[model samples]
Target: MNRRTFIESMGILGAASLLPISCLHMQPTTNYKLGYQLFSIRDEMTKDPIGTLKLLKKLGYQDFEIYGFDAEKGMYYGYTAADFKMILDDLGLTVSSGHYGFSGFLNAPEDILIRFVDQCIQGADTLNSAYITWPWIAPEQRTLDNFKIMSKKLNIIGEQVKAAGLGFAYHNHGYEFDDHNGQNGYDIILSETDAALVKLQMDMYWVMHSSKYTPKELIQKQPGRYVMWHIKDMDTKTRDYTELGNGSIDYTTLLPDPIASGLEYYYIEQGGNFAQNSIQSATDSATYFKEHLQKYL
Candidate 1:
């Protein structure tokens, strides 16, 4: 049977029967590390990547997920990948993942797509990131055909990333859940791609905003597919970005089954509408994680 068919037949049964009871209760074997996405402080990163890293370190963030890798410049936020790696090392921070746009893969010629993937692999290797993620799909390119094309390219790129000793992932936005002839873009991508090659980095706010599936339900439906999570909360009223504890998602319920969810790393990401200063917002999220979320970890 195909991957999607097999997944459907198993349903929640597979996840329920296969997952160890201890996964729901056992503490993480290693140190529980909390991370932040540098996009949360894009302005600071643009002005001074080093200063941003230092401040994030001071806020008790040990890991990060970065964005804006310029393939042509061979840099992220204007620093060469190697230089950025050095800065991270000096601050005792690790970049577990980074976001890269896939426009070249979607629109460029085959040779250009190959070059883009090569650049991504090189940058990811330099930063020692575990996953290099495709983070967005433009509104105009949300068709099923586009998703199919993306799936094929993602599988190809994922293989190259795997060969380079890293992983490839897709980061979700609410658009993926939009209905398309009864099969959403997300369903197409998940079903069409090789699971071993393409992992998922689920954003909590987007998942909630989609109103289709909850984080826990998605985990149960597609066990071991999601490897990373963007932990942003939705305001109860506006359903927009809010600091961790101040929002609507009861992470307390969703975070306990990391093994079942295939969650290896999670980064707190607050996108705009910060309750206070962005740095302070990040600190508050970190504080909540340390005080409340660590128990699950």
Candidate 2:
């Protein structure tokens, strides 16, 4: 089904009956790390990163995942990698992963792509990020041949990032699941990329929104391939952003096998529509996480 149709057809499930039967046996893990994606509150971050980070830290977040890395400026949210690292250090937070745009890899000259990757590796190293993630592929760039080319480019980039002593991962949206000749872009990505050199940052919301697979099934199908998770929820009615525990996704079923999924870090992220204020949403989500989800982590 197309994305729009899927979203409209999937009505919101009430909180009292949201958990799926599959999640009944799932249990939490003590070894997991909980983090917040900066994108969850991008407005606050863009205005005052230090203040924003301090607020998040105070709200009980211990780790961070950054997005919108500017290669030209060698910065994230207008702070150089070194500066950003220092700020995070002072707040007692560490960056686990950062999303890096891949348009350069797709459209830039060969030399430019190499330089971009090199710069990204250096920046990630400075921030002590465990993973440098390729976060999005523009819709116009999603053809079958483009997927093949992107897969090859990702392998090369992954090898370079691996050599730099960091992991490389790709984040997905529902579009990657688009069917092409009995296969899909996601299938190509999985088969063409070197699993040893590249890992996946699974966005559970998008996976579910695709209406093609469940997070648990994907974890089982490609064990050890996913290293990080973007922990967001889908509004039962709109299929849009919502805080964890309030949405239709059942973390109870998915968090049972972190070992099987190779999940080390999971970050809370709400794309745009916060239930209340951003800070309040984050605070509420964190509270729900500690009270409901922390035990399973």
Task: Give the candidate number with the greatest TM-score.
Answer: 1
Cα deviation at 177, candidate 1, in Å, is 0.6
Q: Write the per-residue lDDT of candidate 1 for residues 86-190, one digit (tens) a residue.
A: 888888889999999885469667688888889988998999999999999787888889989899988988898888889999999998898877889888888
TM-score per model over all chains: 0.89, 0.88
TM-score of 2: 0.88
RMSD per prediction, one decimal?
A: 7.0, 10.5
Q: How do the residues 1-297 of candidate 2 rate in per-residue lDDT, one tens digit apiece?
A: 899877666753343247653343245544666799888898899888899888888888989888898888899898899999999888788998998988657966767888999988988999998999999888789888888898988898899899989999999989899888787889889999999988998998899889388877888778988888888888888889898888898876655356667887889888878888788889988988888777666
Clashes of each: 0, 5
For candidate 1, the per-residue lDDT at 226 reads 90
Tell me the lDDT of model 2 at 54. Answer: 86
Q: Looking at model 1, report the run of 10 residues with the lowest lDDT sum.
A: 21-30
lDDT of 2 at 91: 79
**Candidate 2, residue 46: CA error in Å?**
0.8
